[model samples]
Target: MWKLSVACAVLCSVSSVAHSQSNVLLYGIIDEGVQFNSNAGGNRQYYLASGELNGSRWGVRGSEDLGSGLKALFVLENGFDVNTGKLGQGGLEFGRRAYVGLSSGLGTVTLGRQYDSVVDFVGLLEAGDQWAGYLGAHPADNDNFNNTNRVNNAVKYTSRSLGGFTFGGMYSLGGIAGDTTRNQIWSFGAGYANGPLVLGAAYLNVRNPNVSFYGSGGTVAPTTGGVPGSNFGSSPVISGYASARTLQVIGAGAAYTFGASTFGALYSNTRFKGLGDASSGPVSARGISGSATLNNVEVNFKYQFTPALLVGAEYVYTKGSGPDGVGDVSYHQGALGIDYFLSKRTDIYAVAAFQKASGTDSSGKPAVASLSQITPSSTDRQTALRLAIRHKF
Candidate 1:
C-alpha cells in the first residue's frame, strides 16, 4: 500500500497549502455491505456489495471570502467502490461532483457538471436519498427521484432562502456545433421548509435525453441493437422508452415531521415523446413507434425509537403505458429498514425489500420484477436483504 500512502501524503500537502489561503475541508464516507437476492435470473444469489445504502465517496470543498456578502467556492467529490477500490461513476476523477461557483446574498450560481433543478427540489424528499439508499430506489429510478441523472455543461442558479422558501433553475447547453437545439436540458424548481413541514416541486425537459443525460453519465454500451444514444438497458423501464426525441418529468413531494416521527408522500410523471428511431436508433421489443409515459407514487413513514436508532417503511406503485396499443405494465414495491448510529460519524443499517410486476413490459413480454440498482429478476417477483456499515469523516 505504498502507493496509497504516497497519494495520501500528496493530498495532505496540497490540502495544507490550500487551507492556509482559504477555508477548506476534506470529508468522506466508507460504506460497504453484503446482500442476498431471492431471485436474480431466477436463481438465488448473494454477494458483497458497495454503496448499498450510500455511495462511498471523498470530497474537498473550499471557499474564499471575496467581499461583503460574497464568496468564491468550489467542490470536488469522487465516488468509488468500497469492495473493489475501483472508481465509481464510470472512473472519472471527481465523477460524483465538480463545480465552482460564487455565492451572494441574492443566491448562488455555478457552472460545470451539476445536479438539475428537479433533484435539488424534489429528490431529497425520497427515503432512498435518506435511510433507504440505492436499494430503495424506485423502479429503474424511472423518475430519477434517486438521482440517476446529472446535467453536464450546465449553468445553475439557486435563490437565497426567503422566509424558508427557495427557488432555482438550471440549463445544460448541448455544445453541439451546427445543432443549437440538440442535447439541451432545462428545469425549474421551488421548495419550502418551515418548522415541521417541507415541500418541493419541479419540472424538467430534455431533448435527446439519451445522449444529453444518459450517455454523459459514463454508462457505456458501444452498441445496443444499433441504438446510437441510449445507454440504459438493464431493464424495460427505460429501454422500452429510449429513442424518444424528448423526455419530460414533473414531480412534487412533501414531508411532515412531528417529534421523532416523519411521514412523506411523493408523485412523479415521466413522458417520452416521439419514440422509435430510424433503424439507426433504439429498437423496441415490440417495435413501438409512438410515445410512452410512467407514473409513480410513494408513501413512507419513519420513527426514531431513540436518538441512535430509527426505523422506516415505504411503499411505491408504478404504472407504465406505451403507445401503438402496447400493453401496459405495473410494479408494486415495499421496503423496511433500520439504522442505528454508534456515533454521529458511524452507523450500521439493514434493509429488506420486495417487488412484484405484472402486465406486458416494453420487451413485449410478460413483465418481470426489476428493482433499481439490481438486475431484472427472471420471475415476476423478487426480494432482497442487505446489511451495511458506514463511516463518515
Candidate 2:
C-alpha cells in the first residue's frame, strides 16, 4: 500500500508539470460603427457598418514548450461582419491569419497564410494602424498600409530584437504547377527604436499583382480586356489597372515621442507596370504596355489627453500618374479622430475625414475624389464621418 501511494503521487506531479508547459487561449474583438457618407453610389447615404476602426475577429492561439529555449506556436484567426454575422475574406474560415511556427532566442520562422514584412513593420507607424484606421489610409491604400490583403502559402522569418533593432522577411510561393514565378511575392523590412524615436522601412514586389496578390481573376487571357472579380472592388482609383503584370512598393516612416504626445510621418511609392499588351486591341480603350505610379506623403500626431481619452489628426498628400499620355492626378486628405476608453478592453471612437482630387484620372477624365471605398464623388471632393465602438477580449 505504501509503495502504490508513492507511485500515484509521483505520476500526478508529472502530469501537472506537463500541463503547465502548454497553454491555449481564445480571444476576440468586435467593432461596429455608423457611417455618414457625403455620397454613395451617386447618392447621400447613411449606413451601419462593421470594422470601421478595426475588423471584428476571433482567434485561437496556442504554444507548447519544447525545452531548451525553444517553443512551438500557432494562431488561427477569422474575420467576420458583425452586422450580418457573415465571414470575411471571401468566406475564408481563417482568413485573417493561419500559421504555425517555431520561436527561440535566435528568432522565429513561420509558415502558412500571413502578412508580409511591409505590413508588419512600417504599417505600425502609420496613422492607419496607430490611430485613424481605414479612413486615414492613403488613397486606395495603394501602398498596402491598410493590410488590404494577406499572402497565401507564405514563409516568413523575424529576427529577435537586438539593441532596439529588428528585421523580417517574407516570401509567398505562386504554387503553379508549371510556373514557379506566376504569382510569387517577396518583401523585407527593418525597424529601429531608440528612446522616443522610431523608424522603419520596407520593400515589396509582386509578380502579376492582379493575379498573384489580388486574386486569381486576372488569369484569363489578356484578350479579356481586364481581370474579373479582382479584389479592387468598387474603388475607381486603381481598379482599372488591376491587370498589371507587376506591382512594387517602397515605404518608410518615422515617429517621435514627447511626453504624452507622438508625431509621425510616412512616405510610400507604389508602381504598377505592364498594364496591357500593345497588340491586345486597346485593352479596354487605354494604351497598352502603359504603367502607373503613385507617391504619398503623410504626417500625423496623437495625444493622450488623459488615461482614458485620446486625440489624433493627420494630413496626406498624394500624387498619381496614369499611363503615358493618360494624365496625372493628385489628392489632399485631412482627418481627425478621438477615442474614449470605457475600460481596458473597450472603447468608443469617432473619425472625420475630407478629401479633394485634382488633375486627370486613369480614364483620361478629371479625377473624382473618394475616400478608400466610401464612394466616388460626382465632383472633386468628398467627406465622411464615422462613430464606432470596439471591445476586445
Rate residue 252 of model 2 by lDDT.
95
Model 1 residue pairs with clashes: none
Model 2 residue 382 CA deviation in Å: 0.8
Give the per-residue lDDT digits (tens) of candidate 2, residues 1-393.
Answer: 999999999999999998899999999999999999996657888898888678899999999899999999999999999999988877888988999999999999999989988898898888878768888999888898888778888999999999999999999998889988878999999999999999999999988776667762222334343434345555667766666778899999999999999999999999887777322122436553568888999999999999999999999999998766453889999999999999999999999989999987666677888788577788788899999999999
TM for candidate 1 is 0.92
- Per residue, candidate 1 scores C-alpha lDDT tens digits across 1-393 of 999999999999988876665788999999888899898888999998888777899999989877688989998989999878989888878888889999999999998888887789999999898888877888888778888777888899999999999999998899989988788999999999999999999999988877777776666556655657457657766776667788899999999999999999999998888787642247665677778888999999999999999999999999988876453889999999999999999999999999999988776778999888887899899999999999999
Candidate 1 wrong stretches, greater than 4 Å: 1-21, 223-229, 325-327
| Least well predicted 10-residue stretch by lDDT in candidate 2 | 216-225
Please report, in order, the local distance difference test score of every candidate based on alpha carbons: 0.86, 0.84
